[model samples]
Target: MSEFIVFDLEFTSWPGSLEQDWSAPGQLREIVQIGALRLNDDCSVVEEYEALVRPLANPRLSPYFTDLTGITQEDVDQRGRAPAEALGDFLGFCRGLPVLSYGNDMVVLGENVGWARARGDEVKNGFLSATFLNIRPWLNFIVPETADANVGRLWEVLNLPKPAAGREHSALFDCYSFTAALKHLHAMGHWLPTGFL
Candidate 1:
């Protein structure tokens, strides 16, 4: 394939959610946003895809979530698509390429899709049919210092220029930051896993 996909997701969260593993009552990691880009051998962006998804179990956005991501309840209520609908479209945009994420976002993606499927939502080109590779382990091996950095913080952690717009938690901005890191790493002659260019 001439292109590969790097994607990011923004999911529902509240105070202590990450530490608590969202085990609190009525909490689900419903994906609020999906961001991805298709890149060629040179790390140039060939295409971009983004979507806002509405959560089912908890249709409301948490105060902490809004504070962190700048994605308000209004945005989701006004623009978000249903989880299955949004993700199915995202899967179609992936075009079956090797999909990569900074962390185990694929698991979160799977969980949401699984929940939707359990609710009798038909999701074509589902998560099971998609190939997901977590780039965290390989990245840690190459740049140990960045092992603890967040996906959206990669470029800043590497001392590269900040992306033109958007902040750390937003999915699309994070994808741009990821792409920037790949470009910088490629230019520096650092070893990357095969097929990343």
Candidate 2:
């Protein structure tokens, strides 16, 4: 059976008042956490992977980022590894599987790759060629009522339990929620294999 690597990421961000435009290619947000689940064809999770990545450009976690994702400077400093190491591990874990992600994970992944390249780190070419399935459009297609639903709204619409308070933005937790939503959609007779829109 084919596997799908469903994943999420948490990244560093400045406060709204101090936020710089991330329009420039190299100025994109730095990822701090990676969380993913490997799912069988039936959508049952086969394994899980989680990592905390140290930010090279923004070593200290911003207050806004901590408040939003509950990831602190201490957490990153104590538990995080270099982005290249973390991403390398992640890519290895996801080898041979199509990736599934919510929202802008692909954009962030691309930005991270660029950041790595600029730093002279050799990122895996497999990641550059990997197929990515964005869950939003597929979810919308399957559940017309949720056509424009964001993550929270999608969870509510699917009757999936709300994430515990203060845990919404963490990568692993979000992955779990997204996976639950996908399983619920599948149970309702709308199973979508990866990249099958």
Candidate 3:
């Protein structure tokens, strides 16, 4: 049996396009939230976890960021945990299971490992490593002629019910929507069962 996990992350972004400078500072991404759900080989929900992480490089949360994510400075102050420790805990919570998150940024996963490495966290190297599948690339490979590969667009293509307004930006909400979209695609015969739950 092949278990699979789905997850999403929210990040703090600096104002600029990746092409403008392409450096970390120029286009910084600080992980804010992570939401993950684990599924058994048969696609049944097994476990879930969510967490808020404080930015290590940039402590300040911009007004635009707060407005867009609905995560306020007060929220960060009240609940934000140290990035490294929080990431370690989240990974520990997973018990060495692989994760599936939207896109190929891998920023959050990298941070999850890097932050742990810095502190000599107990998780093994292989445990920290993950199997990352970019949803865009997966969709493009599966249906090359179509342009809409994101969850929002994929939902429309699969004729699945639309998500509530303003729900895409949240990690937890997006994770659930992404799962449904994938299921819809599978139902339409567009996606084969990968034997990965």
Best by TM-score: 1
Q: Could you give candidate 2's per-residue lDDT for residues 98-150 as a string of tens digits? A: 88887868788778878888899976554754567776776777777777655
Clash pairs detected, candidate 3:
none
lDDT of 3 by residue, 1-197 (tens): 66667777777764552345426653456678877768764445677677887876667887767776788777887899877666666666555566666576466567556755766764344444455555666665665543555543455565667743446666666766677766656665765336432
Residue pairs in clash, model 2: none
Question: Candidate 1, residues 1-197: lDDT per residue as tens digits?
Answer: 46788999999999999999999998889999999999887778899899999998889999999999999999999999988899889988875577889999999988988898999998777655557888889887777888889999999889999964989999999999988887887787874677543
Q: Considering TM-score, which of the candidate structures 1 and 2 is the better prediction for this target? A: 1
- Candidate ranking under lDDT, highest first, comes to 1, 2, 3
Scanning candidate 3 in windows of ten residues, the lowest lDDT window is 17-26
**Per-model lDDT:** 0.87, 0.77, 0.64
Backbone clashes counted, model 1: 0
**Global lDDT of model 2:** 0.77
Which candidate model has the greater lDDT, 2 or 3? 2
TM-score of every model versus the real structure: 0.94, 0.85, 0.77
- Judged by whole-model lDDT over C-alpha atoms, candidate 1 comes out at 0.87
- Compared to the true structure, candidate 2 yields what TM-score? 0.85
Give the number of the best model, judged by lDDT. Answer: 1
